[model samples]
Structures are given as C-alpha cells and as structure tokens.
Target chain A: MDRSMFVSISYFLTHLGLIFFMYPTDIIASTDEAYWIPITLGIIIHFIFLSIYMKGLSYFPRKNIIMIYLSHGKIIAWIFLLPVAIYLIMIIIITIRSYSEIITIVFLSNTPLWAIMFLLVLVATYLSSRGLDSILRSSLLLAILFLPLTLFVCFVSFQNVDWRYIFPLTTNDFRFITKPSYLMSYFSIGGVFLFIGFIQPLFTYKPKKILYTVLLLVPFWIISVYIPILTFGNSTVPHFYFPFVEAVDSIDINWLMFDRVTVFFLLSLITFIILFLSLILWMFMQIITTCIPKFRPNYLLILISFISFVCCLFIPDWKDVEDLFLINSPFRFFCLLIVPPSLLILGIRSKRKEKLENG
Target chain B: MGNTMIKVFFLLCIVLTSTGCWNNKDINHRLLPAVVGISKNGDKYKLILELPVLESDNMKIQIIKATGKSIADAVDWLSMNMDRGVDLFHVKLIVLDKQFAKQGLTDVMSGLMRSREVAPNAQMAICNEDLDYFFGNVQKSKPPTGDYLLDFFEKDAGWTPNIALTRVWQVYRSLHSSTRDVIIPIIQTGKLTEVEHIGSAVIKNGKMVSQISPNDTLLYNAFDGQGTQGIVEVMDLATVLILSDWKSNKSMIINEKPFMKSQLNLKVTILETKGNPSMDLIKKDLSTLITNRFHRMLTITQKKQADILGLGQTFRTKLPRAKLKNWREKYYPILKLDFQVNVDIQNEGFLKSD
Candidate 1:
C-alpha cells in the first residue's frame, strides 16, 4: 500500500478511537448549554494545526520528523524528540489504562484490570514489533471492516435522540470556548495529525489530500461530542462516565441477531484502540531507536512494553490514571505546539541552504 | 529443540491466560426470565419473575417470587433460591404496580440503568392490578400466555396505535430530561383475554401523576408526534373514522412568556358508518373531536404537572439556558399551547360513499 494510505488510516484510527472514550466528558465539562461552541472552535484549531503540521512535513520530503530534527543537531533533536516520545508513551499508557477501566466497568466487571491491560499491551507489543508496514496494513483492514459499522451504530442511535437538547445555541457563556478542557479537546480531535510528521519517510502525501481527510473527519469528531449531548441532554451527560457508550447501549436493534448493539460497537472500538496502541508503541520505539542508535530494536520493544506493563499495574485506579493524563497535558501541548513549527522552520531553512549551495 | 521449546511455552501461555472465560455461564444452567414484576411491600420490594418452560409440544411458565429491601436484593434472594442462575438479559417486559410507581422509581430506575444484564429497550409498564394476582392468572393459562406479553408490545405483532410503547431507556431519559416525561401503558389482567391494556400512566419527576384512558392515549400519541393508527367513533354522525397517518409540528414564540403552537395533520379513512356523511362534515367533526380530546388530555397533564406531551421541548428551543433549570415545575404549567388539527379523509371505506 502507498504510504499516504497508511498515514490516513493510522491518523483516522488514532483520532476516532481514543476520542470515543473521553470527548463527551471533555465537551460537557467545558461548556454548559453550548457544546457546539467548543466543538466548532476545536475543529478550527484542528485545521490550523493540520496545515502547520503538514507544511512542516512537506519541507522534509520522505524523511520522518525524527530524521528532520536530527539534521539540525543532536541537542536540538533530543529537545524536539524527547517530549514527543514521552507524550506518545504517556498516551499509550493512559489510553490502555482508561479503556481497560471502561471495559472492566461495562463489560467485564469480574475481570482483573491487570489481566485486561496485560492482554492489550501484549497484542500492541506484538503488532509494534511487526514494524510500520504490517501495522498500517492491519489498520487499513480493520478500518475498512469497522468504520462503517461504527457509523451505522451512530446512525441507529439517532432514533431516540431529542434534537431539542442542542437548541438555544445562542445562550452559551462564550467564555468557555477558551477554557483548558475545551482546548484539550483539540488534542482528542486533531492531535492525530502529529503522526503525519513521524510517518513522512514511509510515504509521500499531498498536503491537500491529508487536509481533506482531516476535514472529512471533522463531522465524526462533531458526532462523537454532540450525539451524546443531543441524546442525553447537558444535565445527564455529567453523571455518566462513557456517555457515548451508554448512548450506543440505549439503541434497540430488535431485528438484528444481537439484542445489544453496544457490544458490537464496543468491539469495533476495542479493535481500533488495539491498532492505536500498536501505532503509538511503534512511534515510541522509532523515537527511541533514533536517539540510541545502537540498541537492538526488539530488546527496546520488550523493555518499553515491560516498563508500560509494570507502570500500568501500579496505577491503582482510574483516579490515578486521570491524574496522569492531567500531568501529561502540558507535554501534550508542548509537542502539539513546538514540534510542527520548529520542524517546519528547519525544513524551510534546510531547503534554502540546499538551493544556495546548488546555485 | 529450541524452536520446539519456544512453541511449547507459547502454547502454555495461551492455555494459562484463556481462563478469563471463567465468568461465562452456559445456556442450560441459566433461567432467563421473560418478564419481571415489582410491587412495593412496606419498605421492601416484592419481585415476581416469569420464565417459560418449553417441553415437547407444550410450553409452561414458571413464576418465582421474592422480597427484599431493594430490587437487587430481591433478585439476589431469588437467585439464591433458584436451581439455575437467574438472568434478566432476555427480559422483555418490566411491570411496576401503579402504587409502586406512585411512590417514585428513582432508585429502581437507577439500578436498572446501571445493570449490564437488563436490556435498555425492555418495555416498562404500570400494572393497575396486583402483580401477584396478575402473574398468578397469567401462569394459569393452559399453555402459559406469559410469552405473549413480549409480542404484545412489539410494533408488528399485537401492538396497535392506541397503545403507548414506553421502553426502559425512554423512561430513564424522561426522568433526566427536564422538558420531557414518559407515558407508560397501564396493564391489567383480563377476564376474557390474557392481559388487557387499560390506559397509560403519566410519569413526571419519577412518579405517576395521572392516568389517561386508551382513547385519550391515541390523542396523546398523536400530539406526541407518533403516527399511531387510531379509530374515532362519531355517535351523532353514525360513523367511525380510522386515522391512518399522523404528523405534528411544534414551535414556540418567546416573548415575555413562552407560547407553544402544535399543528396536527391527520389522514383518516372512514372505516364504517350507519349513514353516509360528507367528507367536509366528517373532517369538521373529526377536527373538533380530536381538538377537544387533546385539550382535555393537555389540561389534565398540566394540572398534574406532568409534561407527558413533551410540550416543554418546544419551549426549550427558545428558552435561555438558565430558565431551563426549573422548566418542568415553574414554566411548563404556565406555558400555553395552541393546537391546530387538520383531518384529511382519504378513503370512505371499500365502498365509496357521498
């Protein structure tokens, strides 16, 4: 498969899957009646970040972000790459832990948390070890299979929705549009664009194509945030942990073989997160390999997976996992802000230098 | 030798970790209840569970009764006494006695919502008669009729336009949605039939406030924008009209106070009549009849402070965020509704009449 296809698939899975668990809570906490305010603002910021990130990737054609940064200097490279590596690792840890918490809470109440986490990390590590091509191939296959089913579940959930819940749109406080939770939602929605920089070496993609894909996915993010609010109004959204999952659970597909479509929906999400965890694991491994230069890739993979597994075991419960997410927010911002612009400037400068030397 | 050892270790790991399926229960070892009935007994709850036993050429229903302080406790007690583990996953009907519903179902509803075993779409109804008596009578049928209750609520099966179909999720949503309330059908054990649809119990703020007759339920369904087929008998005109299609459009005007406007377009077929009545005359009388009935239902619901028609939803579109806080209590009753009913007579019957 072409590299651009891989980038799109990986990006789509990363953004769509992880947000399924957290976006509803984030949007509800950010705004009172006007969830659309934060959602609209989040999409705008998403596009801006996408353009900057894509422009930076365009500068280093066929070279990943790690390679581009290494060209500047080892010190500059470490400064740029270390935070991203940490951010990726933190995301993997938080996503696996939180989604495991959800699985335990909703489906497998009797299953131990460590067992779920262990199974998740085990699959992700195996997939990560297979390298980028296999990850992309399997991701594409999974996306092809599950994306339509997920959309159908979203469509069926609308049967019980009260559209009036989203009304009185003008009554929003407007100040919440800039709050930290609202800003953090952009990470949930468009933060996947960071992967485009990392995977630039694998394929050459038209910035326009990537931009279109991001635009196409904006409605999905909107649906993810707004559907729960529309189905269960603002008052009820705060009480539930995974409102979207609950919304899906509330759908009744009597004609279908399965009585609870929520199980199917959760299965699709679990598949996506498995791929997402693998993609993040691969990215973290890629960064570690670039920095260390001589470490055996397989050993590094095992070491990182072990560290993640042990850390996951000690993280007592959801409260501690939530605190870890809060702690990682600044690092998340740092990568989202600094990586793209710095790389874009370096890419532009390097191009100018090459032109001068040629001239 | 090393490769074989590695393969053996992998197989061992797979076998060891696959014990995660320990919680899985076999189908034969579980008794899946088809319906659950709850009644308030002092501070405790009396639960009656009905499950069908299928033998060769004959099907019978088994009833289990238990009491505890809460629904879960009652179920736990029942589970302890059962030969097989009791599962509510296949429960299609949940009957709460009207007296129990009147006492508020907030705790019961929350428990049901939180349970993974209960299907969110299970039909919830209010029973007008004692649940024990109803279940006893139901279980007495030659080849038990308990299983028919599921089909009775199904849209394609026994359900008619006159019946209000309320699901567990709808009940939950209404309990949480400030502008919306639920109408659960009230059922009674019938002398001639297995079970009879009495009317509908209007629930507001987690309690039953009023009950509407089945005829009024048709009007309520119409006003609520559910296109249920209904029959309207005009005694003076010596005619019967059947509503084939129903549509309602609701909007609000936000001035000093909110005013709601609901426009109903109903397509009707003249099912039977003693004498021929002009379409124009039938339309006029039908409009008046529906309009009057809807007004009466609305008045009753408003007086009871139950927004069963969900009129507050229309007002919600225009009300600011803060006003919605006490919408059901302070603003909903004061809001005025203007109803416009238009009846379109499509067919007079198999025979065309003037």
Candidate 2:
C-alpha cells in the first residue's frame, strides 16, 4: 500500500517548519536587494539534487536508501552513510537544543531547558519507535489540524509589510553566493528532501512531483525572508536572529483574544518540527540497524534518543548553537550535493549489469 | 492491562509537570507587566515595571522599581525579590527617559533583540519627565491596569496623526537603517487628563537629535502614508479635515549632485470657510498653507541632516546598493528638494457654497 499523499504532506510540513527559524536571517544577511535571486538559486540546486536522489532510488524498487546502498557492499554502504549517520545525529542535537532555547525565550522563561528537551525527545522517540506507518498517519492528522492555522498565519504575516521596501528590486551584487551565510541557507533545504529517499516502497512518490511541491513552496520561502525585509527593510532585518518570528510578532490583529499570534504560529511549527524529528530518528535507526543487524531495534532507538538528549544538554548557549550550524554545513553539502548524482550513476551501472546478465 | 498502564503513565506526567514553576505557572502566581520603563542615572540603570494586580476583576496597578547595571541585571534583582516570576510577553509599552534617548539606545535595543524576552512590536515613546515621576503620576490617574498607558498610542483608542505611534522594532530599524529615521511621541503627565502627547522626538542614527512640533508630526505621518486623515486648521481661509488619503509623486535624479522633486496631494472637506469664496481661491489658499508647513518641516529635516521625512527611501531606486551605505551623510547633505502641494476640495459643508 502506497501513502504518497501522506509522504508529500509530511515533506511540505518539514520544509515549511525549518524555513521560519533561521533561513530568513541567513538569506537577508547574505544580500540586500533582489533576495529572490539567491532564494531561487538555492531552490534550483535543491530541486536538481532531489530529482536525482529520487530517480536513483526508483532504480531499486521496494528498497529503502540504506538497503539499496548495502546491496553493493557493506564497506561501500558504511563509507557513504557514516557521515550521513553523523549528520543525522547533529541535526537532532541542534534542532532539539535550538528549539528548546527558543521556547524558553518566547513563552516558557521560567522552565529549565532540560525539561523541555526531555519532553521533546520522549514524544519524538515514542512515534519514531512506533515505525513509519505511525509517523505517516500522525503527520496526516497534524497537517489536517494545523495546516489551516499555519496558512492563516502566513496570510496575516503580510499585514505590516510595506511594498515600498520592495524597491531596488535588482541589485548588482550576487557575491552573496560565495558568502558562508548563503550556503547556510541550504541547511533548511536539504533536511526535508532527505526523508524522501528513506520513505521508499512504503510510499511511492514521483520525483517530478517535487517540482509542484517547490512551486507551492516558493511563496513560503519568499514570505519567510521578505516579510521581514518588506516590513523592516534589509538594513533592519540583519538585527534579528529569527527575522520571521519577529515579523510575525509585529502583526497586530486586535480582535483576536490572543495578545500574540507568534505564540500560536510557533506552537503549530513546533508540532511540525516534532513530527520531523521522529522521521529523522526513524532514518537513523534504519541506518544503524542495517549496519549491525544483531541488536534489538527498539532498545537502539531509545539509546540514540538518550545520547541525543545528553548531547543537547551540553550545548552551553545560543552562540554554541550557531557555531554547531557552521560545523554542520560541510556535512550538509556532502549529503545534499555529492550523494545524489553519485547515486544516480550507481543506479545506471546496476541496471546495465542486470540487462547484460539477462541477455 | 497495557492500555490502563499507558493511561496511568500519562496522568502521572500531568501531575508531575503541573507542579513545575519554570514555565507553566498559575496566572495568580505570575506577574504580567503591561508597561516597562528604563532610565539611566550615573553608571546604574533604573528599570520600572507597572504590574497590574487582579483584585476580584477590578483592576489596579502596582509600581515596582529596581536599579542595576543593565536591563537583565535589573530584572534579575527585581525578580529575585518578588514571589512571582516576571513575564515581559504581555508588555505593550516601553518608555525611555529623555536622557536615555540622547545617550543612544543601540545597546539596550540589541540586548532586547538578542534575549527576545520582550516583543519588538511593543509601542515605544520618550518621556519628557523623569520615569519615576511619570509612572508615579500615571498611577494616580489609573483606569484599567492591564493596558493603561498602551491606550494613549493604540491606533483604535487615542491615536491621532499628531502622535507618532512608533514601536520598538521601528526604532531598532531606524537605528540600523542608513537613510531612514523614526520619530517617537514625547509624552508628559497632564493636569486634567492622564497623559499628554506633546510632540515627537526625532531619532537619527539611534539617538534623539531634535524635537518637532506635533503639527510637523502630522505631516510626517502623511508623508509615511499613514494617519493621513488628520484635521488641519488653516488661517483666514477655512478649517478643513483631510477626507482622502495621501497621493504623492517623488522623482529623484542621480547626477554628480542628486536632486529630488516631491509633490503632496490631499483632498479635504470644507468644514468652515471665511466667506463664499471661489473654489479656485479656496484651493489656492489651502495649497499655500500646506506648502508652508511642508517647507518648515523640510527646513528642519534638511538643516539637521536627518532624513525624518523618508525622502531617502524614494531615492533608493536611484542609488546603487553599494553607495546607499553613505546616503544620509554623502547624498542627503547635498540633496535638493523642489516641493509642490496640491489640494482638492471634496465638498462644502451644508452652510457654505462656492
């Protein structure tokens, strides 16, 4: 049974959740005018790699990414996926640490950070161990409950935007491409597409459908960065760490009982992030269990989550969180840039070998 | 049996989590301040918070004050002393003393940005008097404590074009922006009323450089394309209220020396006229009056070299992005304005005919 609809919905949710946090700050810090240039370029690169990743996976029907890699040789699989495994763990540690810090600052100032981290890890581990079916079903339910509210927040985020800030539509400097901040924006893009390769036979998805998904995503990417610039120009956008969060906070709808719509917007995004964490954990388990087949999988899941929780506890402050992102960017490029085209080549070779044998 | 075990575990978590004070706390045990004030004396900073205690639905405010080296330090001192935790989430207003406004707010503003304890959208104003005096007098005229001082600038409540309704984020933007400056309303305690909005304090490059009369603030608001419906009392011809929005045309020429032409258009309803004057005559007199106000505003902004009118924003299209960094200094000084005003009379009152 294929759950492509559910897979696509979760893919959209994960990407949307990641965009609002740090992507806007990085994009704005990278360029002054015509932000669309950098944003579109990033998406084009992501689209090319994603199309390749999916096409490569399609060569081996009904098999996940780890299994497909291991079919060649255990050394080959381990060599390719050890960094993938490390990057996945880094993603968990950073996301958990950073999001918990945000929650403490935003609404729960009195609470200890460890408690929030524990709660997040516990909930994410519960669904991760329940397996992919539970993850997919819960995501469908989450999108149904939270999608409308999210769409409503996105619409109202423009309430404070000044179209005048959209002036100087074209700027001369595309040197933003070489800046470290520009590549950091890719961290947001690479995360949501990785799971697409992992969800394989359980949910049959078309690579070309990523074009439609990206078309739908263009407005979100634009709004996430542009809302801050359009509300408070490029000069002012750099002052914020999460410019989109502040932009959403600037929206004033008095008739609503809630004093801050940011709280509501954040609550929904946090749920999406949790759903994403489960998927990442599930992916991590799939990789490790394939490498060492003797260990019981459920206990392994609990152990990885425990290690993640302890690692999150060690991040001293927000500055360390940012430094960790800089360190992770290299792994991100390897996973996003190198792995895809290489996989497609491998798939082509495997297919040619099979045809020769049959003939 | 497994289902019941899961049920008990969930209930136990709720029971254990409810007792934690770090985040989840009872409303009665938490302090939600509506307005926070900051002023500096010598090397120390004084932080003022107006907390509204809910006494059986009838609301009133309690004033709390602390002194420290920074905002966080002051808050720490105060929070340590109080039984309840302080939450800046509901803060609707932040008032800075005149002295604090001059000394520059970049440090304090960035501190707020980094911590993000307070929402950047909170309405901000400069107090003409001491903050202690301002809040002490403010308490005597208390109405409801939850959003007491916020009503003075809330667009729906007491806001008029004469009052420059600036926010923390706008001020922070002005601090960083190369060409744009923000004006925040300057307020003082009133004798008959609760508080009086005197005028607006012009903030340039993160510091208060000059003050403009409230009339000029109305023009500033209209130029920014907000609160354009403010009433204007023109001398000897008529008293008219702006009935339509602002329609402006600005053209910038970027030669060796950049120059600009600015046009202001307003449609007004004739509330009172001197006599049965010709429509053309009335329009001419109104045009002259508005042109004169614009001239006064321009003379002040140009002389001070502060781009409070946001003319630089219009010229952003004319300058390259790299050259825009020095816009206020290099370009703004040598820039010239060819100003024009156009007034359209929408209608006459019942008693008058042209």
- Top-DockQ structure, candidate number: 1
List the lowest-lDDT window of 10 residues for candidate 2 chain B: B2-11
Report the C-alpha displacement of residue A112, candidate 2, in angstroms: 1.8
In Å, residue A263's CA in model 1 sits off its true spot by 0.5
DockQ of each: 0.56, 0.49
Residue runs of model 2 more than 4 Å from their true location after superposition: A31-34, A167-175, B1-25, B53-59, B142-148
**Candidate 1 ranges with C-alpha deviation above 4 Å:** A177-180, B1-19, B238-243, B246-255
Number of the predicted model whose lDDT against the real structure is largest: 2
CA shift at A293, candidate 1, in angstroms?
Answer: 3.5
Query: Measured by TM-score, how close is model 1 to the native structure?
Result: 0.95
- In candidate 2, how many Å is residue A327 off? 3.4
